[model samples]
Target: MPISRDDVLHVARLARLALTEDEVERLTHELADIVEAVGIVAELDLEGVPPTSHPRGLVNVMDDDEPRPPLPLEDVLANAPDHEGNLFRVPAWRQ
Candidate 1:
């Protein structure tokens, strides 16, 4: 389907975009090309083909979990400009 200038303008307005005349003209043609490409894909014959999320099987490789020593409290608080005890302190927010 061909995309119209008004269609492009409507989309831009919905997106809160302030498009220039040149940009609107460019996007009108670009969006039409994209729609035509999608139409071509929609015409493909896949009657016997199974729907898939991916073309190939996926496998996740994860490292074994191991216990580790925690960083010292002083080391963790070293970079804090303002801290109360072991926690970083920030300005209180007002409702």
Candidate 2:
């Protein structure tokens, strides 16, 4: 069966929530309607059909990994806003 008004209030209290009386009543009806609809779906016949996570088959799109040459030190350092020798300098972050 669907949840009741008292059930909603009990749950809210357990979750440390503070709901008005009106909210509890509204949620009870909403939840009941949803449960009734779901009951209809559960009664349907879906025999001999395999369950699927997705409607269509999916495939990964990736390229094979390969080694490459490194860029020049001067070219890499040129993009840094601030640098000390060959190393990039960043603002202090940790306390």
Candidate 3:
């Protein structure tokens, strides 16, 4: 099915886009070409082919999580310019 100027205009209105006459005309052709290409792909014979989300097999390379000793409070606060008690002090956002 070929995309029409009215179809493009309707979509533009829904998206809150302000398209010019030239833009609407150009998109009508471009969208039509895209739909036609997808239609060609849809016509392929692949009844036995399993659907895949990615072209290549992928696996997580991360190591298993392990508990570790916490850092010293002095070391953690070493880079802080301002701190109150054990917490970093930040400027108040609201009056």
Candidate 4:
């Protein structure tokens, strides 16, 4: 069941896309080929193979969470473009 040029037009209409005639022609052949190629994957026999939760083995590579000595307040605020008291100063949003 290869999709036709009209099928592409119908899909574009359904998606509210405004495709040129050339785009419709291009997508018709490309989408049809993609669908046909995907059909080949259905022929694979994977009945006995266990379904994997993740394609690649999952692992957590994280450092243990631990508190550290805090940086000096002056050192933290030293590089700020604008600061008021202990907070970074920003543009006022409301009058």
Local distance difference test scores for all models: 0.90, 0.85, 0.91, 0.90
Report the lDDT tens digits of candidate 2 across residue range 1-95.
86877788888989888988788888889888888888787776899877788767666868889878899899999989999999999878776
By TM-score, the better pick of 2 and 4 is 4
TM-score of 3: 0.44
Candidate 2 residue-wise lDDT at 57? 63
Q: Which residue pairs overlap in candidate 4's backbone? A: none
TM-score of each: 0.44, 0.41, 0.44, 0.43
Q: Tens-digit lDDT track for model 1 on 1-95?
A: 78999999999999989999999999999999988887887777999988788668666758789988999999999999989998999988755
Model 4 per-residue lDDT tens digits across residues 1-95 = 78988889888999989999889988998999899988897788988988778869677769989999999999999999999899999988777
Residue 30 Cα positional deviation in candidate 3, in Å, after optimal superposition? 2.4
lDDT of 1 at 55: 60
Relative to the true structure, candidate 2 reaches a TM of: 0.41
Q: Which ranges in model 2 have alpha carbons more than 4 Å from their true place?
A: 6-20, 59-95
Worst 10 residues of 3 by lDDT: 52-61
Provide the lDDT at 82 for model 2: 97
lDDT score for candidate 1 against the true structure: 0.90
- Give the residue spans of candidate 1 off by over 4 A: 44-95
